[model samples]
Target chain A: MQNEKMMLEIQQKVELIERAAQAGTGIVEIGSFVHPKAVPQMADTDEVARRIKRYPGVEYRVLVVNKKGLERAGAAGIMKAKLTVSASNSHSLSNLKRTPEEVIKGFGECADYAVAHGIELSGAISTAFGCPFEGMVPLEQVMKVVSCFREMGVKELSLSDTTGMANPRQVYDYCLGVREQFPDVTWNLHFHNTRGMGLANVLAGMMAGIKRYDASFAGLGGCPYAPGATGNIATEDLVHMCHEMGIETGCDLDQSIAIGRDVQKLIGDDRGSFILKAGKCSDVVCS
Target chain B: MQNEKMMLEIQQKVELIERAAQAGTGIVEIGSFVHPKAVPQMADTDEVARRIKRYPGVEYRVLVVNKKGLERAGAAGIMKAKLTVSASNSHSLSNLKRTPEEVIKGFGECADYAVAHGIELSGAISTAFGCPFEGMVPLEQVMKVVSCFREMGVKELSLSDTTGMANPRQVYDYCLGVREQFPDVTWNLHFHNTRGMGLANVLAGMMAGIKRYDASFAGLGGCPYAPGATGNIATEDLVHMCHEMGIETGCDLDQSIAIGRDVQKLIGDDRGSFILKAGKCSDVVCS
Candidate 1:
């Protein structure tokens, strides 16, 4: 029954990825190439990568923790791999069983492997804002990780609020600081709606001139440390807000909402999607 | 049976209001003095007003649609009454059975009654962002209502996103435009999380120099026009963000979260409170 459920989930993810590409998503993180025994949910990421029909002009990426995960990703014909580590030592020790420095040191081998295989590599710093076991991660700690990624030739970097403990002011200040310090690197923001500041943090990052953001369908995913927390900012909700503000995200709002609804049904519960529940702003009624 | 349930709800609300005041809430909108036939849930606002233990520093207020509602509020010994109208004519027609202009015109009598009875009156414009019956309400329409309120001797005003259709850019621009045009008016913002842009809009308003936000405990309030929608931004979530950003809101964050949890248990649902669900950012645990 577990294998059957995993197979069904893999097929559903493929369909969701196709629908997302059709809705004009520029990039999609298909899945993480993690140990199957540790995360059974992402056990079939290789199969998912092989089955997805790649859309032209859309980048497909996967999370890789080390050279082994990157090798698996390359074997699955994945072109882009994101190397991730928790910036805070407590989260790093808890989740990865190593300090942040040790994790980044391990990424050196992954970076070299990606370069040798002609695969694009980016860096992601998890718990860049705060950790469940530790309060706020210092800016110096995050900056140290960014500097390491830069030295490893990673140009695209993401600062992820793993526990949704980020405030707009903190986000804005951190984005501004990073951009000023690392002018050549592309910055992305990943925020969870844990404390309901996901969109607010996005707004702050945008004001600080950061563009790329990561969101999940129907607001799926949550922190294992912060139990009962909501997931990343909903993609449909984010697209709706951007379109309403005339920001031109190059996404189909209706299609995104449709995908959100489909994902909610697939999950057998309301996944905390705002646009999925409230409809688009243009969905006016004749009251 | 209905009366019994309502009486229980009334007692719960009194407890909630008293708890909120103890948690250092500056202003509390206790309830609406609308017709009981229209809104049966708020039928016992008079009783709620009479039963609550008032705090010395906190101001207790209620919503009043017209002179009749204002009179009822006065009879209940409520010193502060907020006269409300919809900025969008379509919403006004649907909810109030009149146009925005007509509603403001009628507020003249309300203003007169408040003055005669020594009741402090403020103005609130609902659907100031967008309306369910109309997509986007024009800024001029909102300005017209503000001008009327200024003429009616209402110095404090609140612009409410009734259906949560506001984007951050729109909020910032609108707030800037209104502050520039009406320099003397003290502005507050009321946003719903109908589309999950509530906190984002609040950030925009703050960036544009507007303070004084309205939030509900446990996020317990929804748009009747937009079914299956979330309510106002949770007060605990907002205070948590403010405290994290180093902005002092004079609120006790832990007490606010406790009240949110209590409200959720009373209502027998989660009610979409982030802090209530995830605990505070300070809630650290050993891994």
Candidate 2:
């Protein structure tokens, strides 16, 4: 019963995340707030918020889908939260089952939640780079998404290349456009390695002066919608890239790789990660 | 019969190469100078030289084993040749069956051939950063190996992080030492993605001012000695990195990926490459 798929326990999720945070997990994305009837896995955000383990330097963020989700996060003492507004009109409708107008108005409520509680908010524009259903995601459309979120007083925003369909050139062009528009607004890159060019796109972001990025340990968190899409770039792999470029990540590779293994084992899937299989090679000595 | 691996027929190879050049096969490695009995595939150095489909823009490089190998290259009318002296002494013994002393002495002989034929040589110190047989390859040994080739008037060199066992810190430190030792020498890098850090090492290489790199199409080439050791960095992947980062590669990723698929068909191995499976993810929209 424990290993059975679709038999996931919400309480168990709270416990696993608590242990994962204790075991040195970095950048754990706690939930994707949607309809209670839609994604049952994300149903226990309020309870999970109360049960989560908070590391000294870790950011324990909860996903807020609407005013109700934000209010629940606030009630659970989850101060900071992530809010998303999808670029694809169809994706927005299917995910939240709300029209784009409803979604933006809903985020207007999120801005109210932020002002009342001073909640640290990270606004994200999903499918900013591309969409599985719609095909091409325009920079203009993404900019409009961010522009609305910005007007609602949202500052730190992430452009999610959600479907693993973004190329590095598009990343460069799109990111450059965003950076030019935002100037100093903080943005994180959330790219899926589904097409294997995630790291390449990361490089594109770096060249565009992007410092903050979103990476899941062991490359976890695939799109349930896209058939073969994997999660964001592996954290260890990303940190390895930063470390190799003489950039400071302040994270341990060995520890990260270990957690990646743990997450893989917990998920009961052997289909993830490049760093764990290939240990750290940045310090070999040939004599 | 036509598809057999042992067939590097003179006329056939020349004709094939002529077409390959026309089809944009710019850097074709003609042959390695290992003993004819050992890597029998490289026995056609002379024939390759005699009937080369010489193209002014493209490079035709032969790998030299010893002084005798250089002589064969000269007679074959090759202009550019690569001389590799390993940093891993055990690999030196196993691959060349010679001690470091014998290899250096052979470099002296190879130099004589280069000077006699006006050949431009780029010395490669294999296992410069790591080795498979001997876990850690010493930096001094690599520099020493490089110095041996340098003493023979080989001013240009490429560092081979053989088997993808090198790390970025080591790459940075080692390249610093190499830069100090051979101040005016032109240097390139060779890396493998065995452990999934191929591009990380490339970032380190680019940081070290090493621009020219060696990558196989669809990540072709691996060691028969090391089990599960995959090929070098994929050319399309590398080109994508360069193009996205605003680095000029003078290569086309879409065309390269097409070539990769063609080569995969030719070799009958479909298990290589990530970008080929995932396709390019840059700004260029793909159908």
Candidate 3:
């Protein structure tokens, strides 16, 4: 019964993804190839990847943690895969069952698999801003992970605030530091709104010249370790803010908001998207 | 029964203000002197001002809308008062029952009363960002209000986001404009967390060199006109963010969070103050 319910939920998610793609979402992370027993929600990753309607020029990406995940992605025929390693050793050990050094060492086989399978691979450094077990992450340690990914021939990288412990000043300074040290890498930011600074961090990243960010519809994705925390900055909220500031995001704000509202209904939650409740600032009809 | 309960709440709020002053808060707006029927939450404003314990060197400010409120504040023995007028004519009429032009025209008597009584006065431009009845406010209109305040001999000024509709880019640009145009004015910011952009706007204001901000304990206040809106940024959240950024706010974060927790218990809600729920980031101890 539980498996059937999970499969139904997955189907609903894929539908939401297709709608999001039609509404100008260029890239979507369909699911993660973790052990089904460990992350039950992602148990049907292969089915999701296979069934999700891929739009023209849109990338359907899956998260891969090890060689097994990479093989699963190949089986699922996923063209793009994100290989993520936690920056903190304690987090890496607890989350991935390996230390950071061990994860880096083990990435060789997975990188080779992606190269051979014609999969476009991108790297992510989780807990780059902070860790639940480690209060503040050192810049040198974060840079070390970046160097390891660069050594693996990855050009696009993401810095993940797994704990939502990032403040605007830290984000601005760190983004500048990373850009200065790794000028050739395309850097993306992933922030959680656990401490309610997600959008502020986005502003800081924009000030530091970062253009790419990771957001969830209705802010659905959150850190499993951070209890009572909210999810990533809502996609509609981010797009709405950018558009209100006269920054062109190339995404239809109203369409994204409608999809966010629809996703909220499918998930039975609207805790993440403020626009869902408050409407747009511009909606306050001008006389 | 309702009036008695409101009086009790007012007593509790006065105690909170006293505690806040002891915790290094140099200024506190104890209550607003709007019409009792219009804003029943502040019906006992004169009583609150008369009863709230005042700390030396700490300004116990009351918000006054016109000559009648100014007289009531005087009778309450308030030494410092904030005379606020809305930037949007619609908001001014809706909130103060007078047009913006009428409010300005009426300020002359209030200004004279303050000067005669030796009351240190400040002017606030409410709805300076966006209006519920009027979408985006023009910078020229905001500047015109600032000029009118300056003409009335007020040096301290507050730019308020009456509906919590201000964005970061608008804040930064407006702060710079205010600083350049009114170099001698002691500029203060008043923001609401309605769309979760309050702290982000505070960051932008700080980047543009604003030193003082208005925050509500436990985020206790919101515009009655802005439906589905949250309160001002929580004092604890703002102070915690500042401390985390290495900025000295001269306020105690733990004490403020404790007060916020207490306020939540009193109000039977915890919708504001992430720190009240998530605790401090430094609470995570590294092994």
Candidate 4:
């Protein structure tokens, strides 16, 4: 009953994706192709991928843990897949049942499968900044993961602060160091608002010249391993900040806020979305 | 009955202030010396000031709106006070029943009273970043307030984002501009987390060479005029970020978090305090 109630149907997932695309989101991580028993909420990912009315100029991607997940994503007609490995061994073992090194070693098969299936592969290093069980993930571990991704022919990569352990200084220094070390690769940042430093870290990344970021609608999604942690930074909050700072994000602020509100209603709880609660700055009237 | 319940008696206020001092807070704004009818919550500020066990080296200050408020603070034996004026005319009119210019112009009497009473006075420009009633406050208006504060012999000033409407770029530029324009004045930053940009704005301010900031314990305190706005950035969250980034704030993280949790319980609600919800990064153990 819990699973049934918590899960979204394939049609609902597809509709949400379409809505996001219509709201001018350039890229959408549709769902994860994990074991149905492991993540029953995403059990209908394949069906959702097949049903989505794909919008032109919008890139649709799915999370694929291994070669099998990639095959499933390919079978569902998804063109882009992101393979992830935790930078810390404890988190990797706890979440994926493999060490970081072991996970990267196994990604060779996934890379070959993606190439054969004509899938565009991107990489994500979970807990790149820090891990829930392992306090601070060292820069060396993140560099090793980046090296492995580069060796696997992944040109686009993201460093994810899985439990929001990243601070602005660490983000700025790390982004600058990584960019200098790997100039050819495109780096993206993913941050959680667990410690209220998500937007601050994003500002740091921007200062270091990192252009891409990963944020969640309605600030949905949290790490199961990180107890009492909040979700990712809200997409509307990021977009709102970007627009306010004279940085154009190409996303409609009102529509994004609407989507966040709808998602909040569906979840039946308050997500960490500030814009949804306070309305946009522009919405405030001049007295 | 409502006022009695909401108002913290002199003894309780003293206890809270002493607790904050024992927790290693270097500066504490004990209470505002506003009229009892106007702000019943702070009606006992004078009594609290007289009763508290003052900590040596820890500066105790109270909020004073005018010369009468300053006189009351002086009579209560408080040695430091903060005088606030909104940078936006709309916010100034709504909160103080005077325009920004009028409020600043009236501060001459406050300055005279502080000098006669031998009290140190600091100035704060509310809505310096953006006004809730008037979307964006111009830098010229903020500069004008700064000039007035300087004229009134207030060498220390803070730029407060009263409604959390500030973006990082705006914050950085404004901080840089104000510091350049008035190098002799000691500038501080204050932010609200209403739109989730409080810490981000703080980060920008720090990047632009700001060393002092004002944050609320348990993130308590909101603007009555700014609809749906949350409170100031949590003090614990700021200290946590500073510690993680290797910046010395001289504030104990664990103690601050404990105070935040206590305040949360006292208020009978969940405050916008990140560190209170999630333990410090050091508290996370490696598995």
TM-score of chain B of each: 0.95, 0.88, 0.94, 0.96
Sort the candidates on TM-score, descending order. 4, 3, 1, 2
Look at candidate 2 and tell me the lDDT of residue A195: 57
Candidate 1: segments with Cα more than 4 A from true spot: A1-10, A223-230, B1-11, B223-229, B284-287
Q: Chain A in model 3: its TM-score?
A: 0.94
lDDT, candidate 4, A145-260, per-residue tens = 99999999999999999888999999998999899999999999999998899999999999999999998889987777655556899999999999999988878888899888
DockQ pick, better of 2 and 4: 4
B224-259 per-residue lDDT for model 3 (tens digits): 765444678889889988888899998988888888
Docking class of 2: acceptable
lDDT of 2 by residue, A1-287 (tens): 11125434667677656655665555566675556666666766677778776777677777777777777777887777888878888777766678666788867877887789867888888878777667778899999888888888788889998877776678878989999998868878898776556776787677778888888777777666544456778887877767655777767676777777776776787544777666665433233
Quality of model 2 by C-alpha lDDT: 0.72
Q: Count clashing residue pairs per candidate.
A: 0, 18, 0, 0
List each candidate's DockQ score. 0.64, 0.26, 0.63, 0.75
Q: Which TM-score value belongs to model 2? A: 0.81
Q: TM-score, each model? A: 0.94, 0.81, 0.95, 0.97
Report the lDDT tens digits of candidate 3 across residue range A213-286: 99987777776654444578888889988887888876788889888887677666556677777788988645
Q: Write the per-residue lDDT of candidate 4 for residues B1-287, one digit (tens) a residue.
A: 11224555667678778988988788899988988777778878888888999888899998888888998998999889999999988888888899978888788888888888899999989889888787888899899889989888898999988888888999999999999999998988999998999999999999899999998878887777666566899999999999999999988888888878877777777778888877787776545
Model 1, span B1-287: residue lDDT tens: 12123234777889889999999999999988988877777889999999999999899999888899999999999999998888887778878789988988898999889999999999998889887777788899899999999999999999998878888999999999999999999999998887888889999999999979999888877656443335788999899989988988989998998888877777676676778877777884334
Highest TM-score against the true fold, candidate: 4
